[model samples]
Target chain A: MAQLSYRDAVARGIAQEMRRDERVVVVGEDIAGAGGVFKTTVGLLDEFGPKRVLDTPISEQAILGAAMGAAMTGLRPVAEIMFSDFFAVCWDIVVNQIAKTRYMTDGQVSLPLVIKTGNGGGLRFGAQHSQSIENWAMAVPGLKVVTPSTAEDVVGLMAAAIRDEDPVIFCEHKGLYASKGEVPDGEIVDSLGTAKIRRPGRDATILALGMMVPRALAAAEDLATRGIDAEVIDVRSLVPLDTRTILGSVARTGRLFTVEENPQLLGWGAEIASIVADEAFWDLDGPVQRITTPHIPLPSADSLEDLVMPSAESVASTVEKALQS
Target chain B: MKLPLSEHRYGEHGVVLPPERSDANDALDVDLDRRRQLYRSMREMRTFEKRAYDLFMKQLVKGTSHLSLGMEAIAAGFGAAMREDDYTFATYRGHAHTLARGVPMTPVLAELLGRANGLMGGKGGSMHLTSVEHGMMGSYAIIGAHLTIANGAAWSAQYRGSGQVAVCFFGDGTTNIGAFHEALNYAAVYRLPVVFVCENNLYMEYTSIHDITAVPHPAADRAPAYGLESIVIDGNDADEVHLAAVTALDRARSGQGPSLVEALTYRHGGHSRADPGKYRPSEEVEAWKAYDPLTVYRERLVRLGVSEDELDAIDASVLALVDAATEGAIAGELPSPESAFTDVWADGGWSWRN
Candidate 1:
């Protein structure tokens, strides 16, 4: 295993997939010559040639719709929607057409399409460009929502997304792109609905997703120092959520706390809480606590933004509250 | 002045039309079988539409069904001419296209009945019928939504080196939507293999086509502007519709380019079962009904040596099949409530959140 950044891992996965299959091609606004906005598709234009690495028009609708079409016609197209927030512009292509094509066709046409975008709020990028709207995508059925928390997860999940016979919305946290992790030299992790245990514990369970997984781990370590053993679970796939892992972890710890960067009202936290309440209510000794951003549009100020999203401190506080209850 | 014939020949014919063989004898030889198929397909669509109208009135179908009764030739002609592997995207009133492409009537009827055996596994009703095996890409209930998808499919075909084509079937009103312009422009810019078959039935629900748009023609004369070939045909005539489709399909398959076929047809029934076409003038409806594609085709077939008994036998066969399918559909089971969440994603499984 070698250490690799999220950006490098994504580039490697895309390159590997393209190299493995001639049908695989990459299309985005600046994916060709400019190597994408974050350079995730760097050197792909030169390595795979122009046909395989295409720079499309600024229209996100066209890029996504064309990707669906390409996938339907036997070509595996990995389309970049730039920022995750930009997915709003292509709802007809992404939600109505691409996601539901197979079911609509009675399982005849499989849309092996992947839409890659960056999520989460940080880097002082402000609201519009840096909102964690992954829950919005997860709300829609027929779409596989994924947020790889680590570089290793990125390589594995992205390859799996490309090869799978369904449309996958592959989200990468912009904050986690520079975070380095040791990825298996070859692709190893490739399950769709399985969550990974980032850190094991017994006193309490902290279920998190995307960039929040690492923060949850940090909080788990901090809680361990205080003799509070907290288990950290990374929800890699949002749509096809691994309920088994979550319920298993929740059963061990009678108390549960969920953390999410999304808003409080309808975030993944609310979903997780509801699932536990509906199915594993007897296993919980106390009410399930959820730590998330306020249900308001993200503010531009960095100071206010810091308060808006769930932090390690907020998670620990929520966990402590759960323990007291 | 009459247009000069091209040097190109099809099946031992001399150059007649630039895109098609112009020699009457040679063209006749090649088009005989195609013409017969077009006639039969259009007849089938007309029969299906008329039967559906009867069923809707009798309350055999729960939801409203859109009948392309008068405009049968356009769907049959263009759809039949498509290559088996080529793609087709259509609007809500897409039953005729699906039938022309040979999707069994039983599934279509079952879908109207909201049965599990339906095309969309009972989720989609009359408006969203789709069959991938026959290349009938799902029809969109939202007007003009399928245009972009069809354009994408065409571009994909070109990208994949399949030499296949795509046909987008939409009503005259769809031309005014943003998707139509965007789709056409994209297809033109990339020289995508596609045909835009605009069924100009002269109304969008209750509104006449003239009231909503400045352009008189459905596609207008925008073909040259978009750098693609364009043609307007009498949609009531199966021969004319088939001929136009053949020309467009040939151009698309041979890598020449895309074409915009404006089929001037009329819808005999209301937009949906709920509307009795109250907005249309009685005289206008009467005038268009005189040129009923089904009747016109039957008359032509009579002139071509098909006896009245033969036509009756064809009619009986179609009616019996439709009746059987309708009965089967009504008897079919509705999908279980648990089925609501089954097809949302692949079989790996996901948690539901209210």
Candidate 2:
């Protein structure tokens, strides 16, 4: 095992994939010479050369469109959208083309492509850059959405996404880029739609996604001190959700709380809560609680941003409320 | 103001027409067998489109379908110019494009009829017909969106050191979209092997190209901005389109980079099946109809010493082929209800429950 930063782990995964498969090419704005804005693709240009590592113009539509075209013609393209907020600019390509191609073509075409983008907020990047809009992509049926919190998950999930036959939206949290964790040596590929139980308990189950996974784990630790055994499950893949893990935990604990950084209305957390409510109605001891960002745009100021986003304290308090009820 | 013939307008833009093949030497230089094949392709497209229109009018086809009534020459020309391995992308009016690329008429008709035997298994319908085996990437319903995608295909070919060239068949109005500009710029910068074929059919849906475009000729005026060599041709003339395509494909194969060919043609019918095209002036339509690509090419074949009896035989064969395809498509089965749940993911596993 080797300790690596989340950003380094993602780069390592891409490099390893490129080395293994010559068809894998990376395209994005400033990803070649500049090594990407977050340096997640650092050293790729020198190792793979410009042909494999392409720096496109500031047009997200062209970047994604080209990637889709390349994928159609037997090339595995890994495209990086600089920020998830800018996904709106190329919504037609993503929603109509990339997501719908395989199904629309009736399996005649397979788009082995990956669209990696920085998601979530914490460092005051403002409304446009900070919002976690995984729910928008998650709502789309064909797309596979994966958000890795730790360095280990990033490496494994990134490798899996590159090798996946379908288009996978790999959402890398900007807040976790500098965070470090021990990753297993050699190649690691985690299956999509499988959630990992980070901590095991019996009082209630906390399903966390993206940046909220760490917060949920911390909250579980806090709850343990107060005689509350809270189980924390990190939802690695949002689209092919591991209902088995989530429902099993809910069945044991008889309580569920979904934590996320996105808005509460029609958010990823709400989807989880709805699923638990529908399937495990009798399993729940109380109403399925959702700890998420309030239904408002994230503010630019640090204080206002802090007030909007969910925290470990909020998760703990939400769990306490669910347990009391 | 009425739009003049595209050839007449080309001189005003200082666009020099490629040297035309003289009629005297055209018979000797052009391969007789290839010319016959090109004529056959045009005839098949014309018959198929007319049949599709009849089906739509009879309420047999489910959704609206676009016809390439007068734009058959461009499709036949590009088909004659490209290899079977070369990738082709087209706009919504792409039936002729796929037919010319060698996609069977039965599956093509089946797709329009939304049958299980369709090219996309009744999923894509008319607007999204694709045959990857034949190198016809797709027919994008969204206008101007496929330009960059075609550019990427060309980039992949170049990266792999493949001699293949990617071709995009779009309309004149597509030039006004931002993706067109972005795609052209990227293609030029990367020296990708792609040919942007704009079938300038005068109208984008109901509105004339003059109303939407700033420039009269997109290929002649705008292509130069991206450092691409642009050629303006008489789209009704199959020989001219074929010559231009050969030149562009050769340039792309030789690593000379991307080029644009704006084929000046006119659609005989409305953009979609429903409209009667009341927006067009009757005189203008009549004037353009005088130069129907099929009629012009049939006369050329007669002048080139092809017997009238032979031309009749070719026409009869095409009609028979179209008839067989139409019957087969109508008799095709409907997709199963469970089919809606499949093909969304490569793993054959849809995340959502039924």
Candidate 3:
């Protein structure tokens, strides 16, 4: 096993897929020679050359639209949107065009492409730049939303997204770019909708995604010290959700809490909460709780941003108070 | 291992020049056989669109449909100019473009009728007509977006060493949108083989394109900004558009980069089935109808010594084909209730759970 950072894992994943398939190509603004603004796609241009790793104008619609068109013709494209919030500029390409192309064309054209974006709110880039839009992608019908919490998952899920014969919204948290984890040396690939039980416990089920996973695990650790055992499940892929694992966990632990970086009201947690309420209602000992940023535009100030977004300390305290109550 | 770069395939046919002044009666490179084929394509598209309008008028076609009633020449020209493997991305007014790619009329008609035998099995109606096997990639309902998509197809062709050219068709309104400029710049920067054809049909939906647009020729006027020559032509003249299409296609296939051609035409009908088109001045409509593509082409053929009987025979045959397509479409069955659940993913199922 090799220790790799989250950002390096992204480049590794893309390179692995590109090496395997001649049809694979990557395109985005500053993703080629500049190695991407977040530095996740470093070395792709030199490795694959300019033909495969293309640097496009600062056009989100162009980046995604080209990716969709390329995928329609014949190419496994991984197009980056720079920032997840920029999907607003070209949401039509993503939600209406790419997401619905396969179903709309009656499977005549399958878009084997991945939309990689730096997602989440921890970097303090403010409201426009930093927003976890996975919930926005999940709301779409024909899209597969994937958020990898670890370096290994970053490589594996990205590989899976590129290989899959459908458009995948792969959200790489801006906060976890520097985070490191042990990744198996050779090619690594993981399924889209499988949740990993990071820390298994019996008292409560703590569901998290992207940057929230680490904090949830840390909170679980804090809860363990206080005699409140918490189970942390990294909810990797939202659309093809691992309901079996979630339901099974909820069944074991009568309490459920979702840790999410997205703002409250229609966050991914609400959907999970709704599901647990309907299916695992009988297994629940108390009402489901969602720990998320308040329903407000994220502030860039470090203290205010830290206060708004959920952290390990906040998660631990919330879980402790909820379990005690 | 990395893939090798592609070399140019269209060696002899280099840059294709537009008519010096956008005249209809420019010196033509077309022969009688080519003219006859172009005439057939135009006739087929014309017949298909007329039948589609008739169906919409009868309330048989559900939802809404955008018809290319008077915009047949542009589709015919590009469809003829493109190879069998070339890709086409058109707007919602795509029935003609779809038919031009040689997709049979029956399935297209059936799709409008929302039948199981439809092109997309009734999943995609008139607004989303697509036949990838025929190289008609898709008919995007949203404006300006397909331009960028065409660039991607071109990029793929360039990457894979394929000489296929991607042609995108949109209306005059799209030229004002950001994606149009973005796509043009991108295509030029990367030197991707793509042709952007703007059917400047005088209107952008309900609004007059001239009123909202900043430039005179919506697409061609802005071509120079992206290092492309601004070429405008009489869309009513099939030969003129055909020549322009050949030029752009050659330029793209030969690795000369992208072209933006503005084909000036007017739609005989409203944007969609919903509009009665009272907003258009009667005299303006009358003047444009007088210069209709089919009428102009028919006159040109006659002036070139083609017999009246031959043209009549072609039109009659086209009408008969449209009739058969309509009959078959009317008889086509509705999609099975369970069929809607399929094709949501590559697994051919809609399940989102493990």
Top model number, lDDT: 3
Instruction: Name the regions of candidate 3 deviating beyond 4 angstroms.
Output: B1-27
Kindly list the per-residue Cα lDDT of model 3 for residues A183-211, writing each as its tens digit: 99898999999999999999999999999
Q: Model 1: runs farther than 4 Å from truth?
A: A321-325, B1-33, B115-121, B221-225, B299-313, B327-342, B348-354
> Candidate 1 has which clashing residue pairs, if any?
B6-B16, B16-B22
Clashes of each: 2, 0, 0
Model 2: colliding residue pairs? none
Candidate 2 lDDT score at position B124: 93
lDDT of 2 by residue, B245-330 (tens): 88899999999999988888889998898778888776667756777888888888888889989999999999999999999999
Query: What is model 2's DockQ versus the real complex?
Result: 0.66
Q: How high is the lDDT of residue A171 in model 2? A: 97
Clashes of 1: 2
Global lDDT of each candidate = 0.78, 0.87, 0.89
Q: Note the DockQ of each predicted structure.
A: 0.33, 0.66, 0.81
What shift in Å separates residue B79 of candidate 2 from its native position after superposition? 0.8
* lDDT (tens digit, per residue) of candidate 2 on A1-325: 9899999988998998999999999999999999999999999999999889999988888899999999988899999999999999898889889999889888888899999999999989999999797899999988889999889989889999999999999999999999999988998888877899999999999998888999999999998898899999999898788888999999999988889899889998788888888899999888888888988888989999988898999889878866876
Give model 3's DockQ, 2 decimals.
0.81
Query: Which residue pairs come into collision in candidate 3?
Result: none
